[model samples]
Target chain A: MSDGAVHCVVVTPEKTELDVRCDSLILPMYDGELGVYPGRAPMVGRLGFGLLKIKSAGKEDVWFVDGGFVQVTREAVQVLTDRVMRRDQIDRTAAEADLQKALEIKPTSPEASALRDRSLAAARAKIRLSSR
Target chain B: MANIRQLDKRRKSVRNIRKITRTMELIATARFKKAMDRAAAATDYTKAITKIVQDLAKSGTDVTHPLLMPHESVKAVDMLVLTANRGLCGGYNGSVVRAALQKRAEIKEQADSGCTSVSGKRGISAFRFANVPVEKTYTEFDDQPSFDAVAKIADELISRYITGRIDRVDVAYTRFVSSSKQIPVVETLLPFSGIEVPQDDSAKGSKIRDDYEFLPSAAGILEEVVPASFRARLFKCFLDAAVSEQIARMVAMKSATENAGDLIKSLSRTFNRARQSKITQEIMEIIGGVEALG
Candidate 1:
């Protein structure tokens, strides 16, 4: 799989940061993680808030993505997301603070409560990844 | 012949107006630059979202999002009127407002024509005039956009869509195309079918095909993604309009300043000629009297 390189591009609202040929790619989807290679079958998946890892040449790169979508065609791969953060860019202290706030937010009403849990989960993920 | 006193007064008046327009032109230029920077930054965001949306459509998902669902009932429509809080740019506000009014009238006419109803009922009278119930108009901001403002507007639109209060949501704005041309465009905000992705071969070449693993589920992520995308897009639109307005104002002022200069120059020349002629006439009369007395 490493020999058959796959071309991919990752785009955020600010810029098209990565456009390179890669050996393989892994994305965190709503259900689970998915892997793609060159000549892969066409499929689309809902991305979740997690690490998006792409391996190209002999180096691996990781990006913390805030929910977007991924499209795979026969020859190219595209990742479009609102926000993408590199590991170096992620401030551990800020992530921790956000995580703490998310955890402390207790919605008294059922209607407003759903997003709190989601935010908490995201905070935890950020912390866990930052520590690594 | 005009009096010297009157000429002096006219020059002073023109000088004051020149000062005002010159100041305005400078301010408008500065604001226009900032707006352009912001507008450019937002493009990346819009492109990223558009790509995601296209990918979702490509992916065969049973997940039905409310934003995606077309409202079959077309009894009434909601228009979001986005206008500058203050008027200075030539037609920036007026053009957008006019486009909105025209659209409203057209929608009313369609409703009146008695088109076939999707729900098998006389679709509510051809046009129900509903003033854009929600408006987000602002005059000033710090450096960047106020996310809170965008969120407030988004919340209102989302609730309206969810409760079936408005069947469709449309936004009317003046899109900044260039310094000389600001086009008034009306785009659908809700029931998101009008969102377009770049179809050029260059865009196609950039398309990414890969499988993704969702943490919770696709449906859950979409509920958040769609709304966030909408809010981001609206913010971008505001930025675009702001930049366009400032540029328009700057250009308008620059031309006005030039016109003022021309007027002052012409007036001064005329005033000087008239004064000279009056003095010459008095001198000739004095000479004639002296010659007659001699």
Candidate 2:
């Protein structure tokens, strides 16, 4: 409700993961990372599999957001993704195993390649976020 | 009068039936709670994505996606009927089948060809008995419908719509209004106009910020968002159907249990009366024998 603070909400298919007010926020866009401040213009960005950093006051909350879409409005920054997890939620061994499995897939067809690529990206993001 | 032993046997069977119905009622109640929680959790995501799609459609940017564009001429149509796989849920499956048949007839009147796909065994069997031809039948979905499972269906429908294989997609499902209320209805899913802007104060409050800056581009985002939203909507239908089926089963089983209780009570009353009458007859016979001997 304040002018200098940004409100962030992360929504997944299962539930609304988090809703909090923060001083600033960073989203991993399809191309790169984009930061949002209180007075940022409204925008919609495609999310990539990476960490979503939200900072309020001095503490920061990091979330591993799977690929989806993000909509930024004046009042709130909405992250619409299939899954969102904290660092602790990501299992390193499982993600690593998934990456290995994804890497072994032969891209024989276009659909297969797409599947392989998506899995590879997702697993890699999970591994990377969890390592941090 | 009926034999007292036969009456007792009937009463025992009724008591056993009551136990089974009561147990089923409890199971349905628990499942209903879980399913309702799942559906409630999905509401936020569904509402958010729908709102985004609505705002994009009303953004007036000449943004047109294939999913958002209506076909010029109606031709082939796809109807997906969602019913419970197992039937014990009173008229849940029946009403859904009726609604689906009604929708199919309406579509036939308007379209040249219609393809019917049904999920759940009850629906498939109903369609078969009705002599209606079904293009596909699915038995995988139960009380818990995963988003991925629903996404596969939505993707197939989307591809069909895009390739002009079908002009529109209609889903006949029971919409769960609350724990106590559910209504079976057919909803249009393609040419994707089902997302209506609510006339509530929230709609007025969240004015479609038309000045939205597209990160990559409006067209690119619309391409992804439109389909994602469509998938979300379809998935929501599955979730609602699941929850409603549980509720219907719970109510049906509760009534069954109550009716069984009443049946058992009446059976016991008759059994007692029969036994009493048998005893009185035996006593009368003994007294008559004594009088004859005297």
Candidate 3:
């Protein structure tokens, strides 16, 4: 880590996508967005499907992450997710189509409703992030 | 002579086979490199998840989940045998099937009812030949297995274990130790008790517990982390099987190509010697005819 930067790493099942020293990190938690800086308390948080913004040296890098988990230690912030992609990688038309499909899913049972809600949230998050 | 002609034919065929085996060896080499890279990349996730699980276990919270608890008694056993879809990889598939069969026999002796699930056509056919009924057969996976595909199977296994449909889940596969060494073994994946927390040397001298703040709660996070760790373990098995398959193929093809080369060399040598002796005989006959005419 530099003077006030924290080491950040994002790992997917297939590979580690990013490893860098960043000034700050804004991650989407299961409940809301949480920002992290150097010397933050060690914590483990469940991630939601949304944007992950890493700011360093007056520049910002953003990525769209599928639901996973994050661990913040004294030295580094680790993000373990299933899928991570750049905002431009999200096809707006496809995301809109997914949202429509998720809406059409009938919540027949508890499991089915849970699935519907998860997909609905994921599609909405994609659409919201890609449009920015 | 006729013998020379036969030798030439055999040499030509051997040469052609050598070409094919050489090509296969090269392909296996390339594929092995790619598979090894993917396996290495997965190590990070596996290490991270294992650390998290260890921490959760040590966080002073009573960790209890369906996966962490053993069944009342051994009843139904699910043995998942991983093999290759295609054969000709020497004893790669054979050893795996053999190991799996031995495990099944042992499990059957203890469990009341059990079923064997096989991945790869080789294992499926072997089980059929052995008159053992297979509960499930997966032939879609090749050298490259996607995480999503493995996760689907893991999800089914997890649900079965949770609902008490099966008492235990075991996987038999070739563990890739390195490029030169692979061992076929059976491992239990469920019950989630295989993870042994490493003893911290620094904390051994004094009682120091790193204070970790949980987002929701330690138990809640453990609930998610445990299943994720299970999925990761299953995926690692798939990856190891894939990489070992390629390495086995590479070595098998290399030896096959070498054998073909040796066969071709000996055949050509015999062909040359036979042709020379035939020429000498014809010359002698011609010289004798000349002597009689004179």
Candidate 4:
């Protein structure tokens, strides 16, 4: 938290992955990516599968996050997810294989469909992240 | 002389047992510290989720999550008992099983077809011996249970609960308070009443309820956050049970080692007395033989 930075905390059920001050942070919402600056109103939103792009000081960092939640206040953004992986950790080949596996499963119910979609999204996100 | 030899053998055996128990106690102590640290690390996540739930509750909106409301009447319930897979942990498994059995008995009339699901071998065997039918048994959850491992179980329970197949869910496990205290308690997991407002320094009385915005509606957020909170709570329970199990084992082994020490002490005392008596008898026999020779 400085003149033009917002503190960001990425939390998961298993562990807290990151806590950093950033100039700008983009979060993956249920529908699309949402960017936040230093002075944003407090809001809560559901997260989807994608890269969490963070630009701090002069460096850029990207992380792959599965569906979770984000609580963005004016001073801070708290991203809570069940899974978070660094950009370098994403494996493109594995993700492509997982995407194929996800596509093959037939969803029996709405919940199953949702789960399948999440897996599909996650696999795609990992592939996209790894390519970059 | 024979008595001294027998005492010496018993003392040696007791000393060996003491060595074993002392080693177990040291191992348990190390594990307990690690378990305690893991539990502490999880507390942050648990508390954060609890805070969000509390803020939602206080936001003055009509919260309408299925998990928040209790099912009508309760036709049947699922009982989950968590115990240690390995059994050197004194009464840790016993306390959990006893509590679970008592709960099973109390809910017998209410639940028509409830079957116990146990996570440890110790508990499953206890239920099996009692002739109680266990529907599921999971032995993979050891002293160190990963979140994914427990999440699968929680996800299953959540799905079953949401489907209305199971009216309620109860779990019996030992709760770790500190290094010295652990209480065995059976609590409701479904129709979850465990979510409470946190009494912490951060974010309490912030009065941000009026300014807060819930994206895609409050209900949509609840759909994800509620289930996640439930999963986290269940995971926390597993962690507590793990830490408590180590404490129980540590205490049990320490006492066993001390008891062995006491037995060795008494055996050595008896050994000394027997040796002295044998020496005195030999001297007397020599004196008698000399007198006879005279």
RMSD of each: 8.8, 5.1, 3.8, 3.5
> How displaced is residue B50 in candidate 2, in Å?
4.3
Candidate No. with top TM-score? 4
List the candidate numbers ranked by TM-score, top first: 4, 3, 2, 1
Candidate maximizing lDDT: 3
Look at candidate 4 and tell me the lDDT of residue B123: 89
Tens-digit per-residue lDDT, B1-294, candidate 4 = 677788899899989999999999999999989888888878778777766676676665555667778987888899999999888889899989999988888898777756579998988899899999999999998777888779878877876776667888999999987778899999998897666744453555554444678887776787888788888889989999999999999999999999999898888888998999888999999999999999
Candidate 3: residue B194 lDDT (0-100): 50
- Give lDDT per model, in order: 0.66, 0.84, 0.85, 0.83
User: What's the CA error at residue B94 for candidate 1, in Å?
Assistant: 1.7
Give Cα distance to truth, residue A7, candidate 3, Å. Answer: 2.3
Runs of candidate 4 with Cα error greater than 4 angstroms are: A87-132, B197-210
Q: Fraction of the real A/B interface contacts present in each candidate?
A: 0.32, 0.58, 0.48, 0.49
Alpha-carbon deviation at B132 in model 4, angstroms? 2.4
**Descending-DockQ candidate ranking:** 4, 3, 2, 1
Q: Over the stretch B240-266, how does candidate 2's per-residue lDDT look in tens digits?
A: 999999999989999998998888889
| C-alpha RMSD over true interface residues, model 1 | 4.9
At residue B184, candidate 4 shows an lDDT of 99
Model 4 residue A9 lDDT score: 92
Tens digits of lDDT, candidate 1, B1-294:
337778878988998999899999999888778777767766765765665555554444343567768778866566665565455567666676667667777877754311111100111111122333323333343234454455556656665565566677777767877767788888877776535533433455644545544434555545666776777777766666667668768878888899889989988997888888888999999999999999
What is the DockQ score of candidate 1, to 2 decimals? Answer: 0.19
Those runs of model 3 whose alpha carbons end farther than 4 Å from true positions after fitting are A56-60, A86-132, B112-115, B199-210
Best by DockQ: 4
What ranges in model 1 sit over 4 Å off? Answer: A1-132, B54-59, B62-64, B108-145, B194-209, B217-220
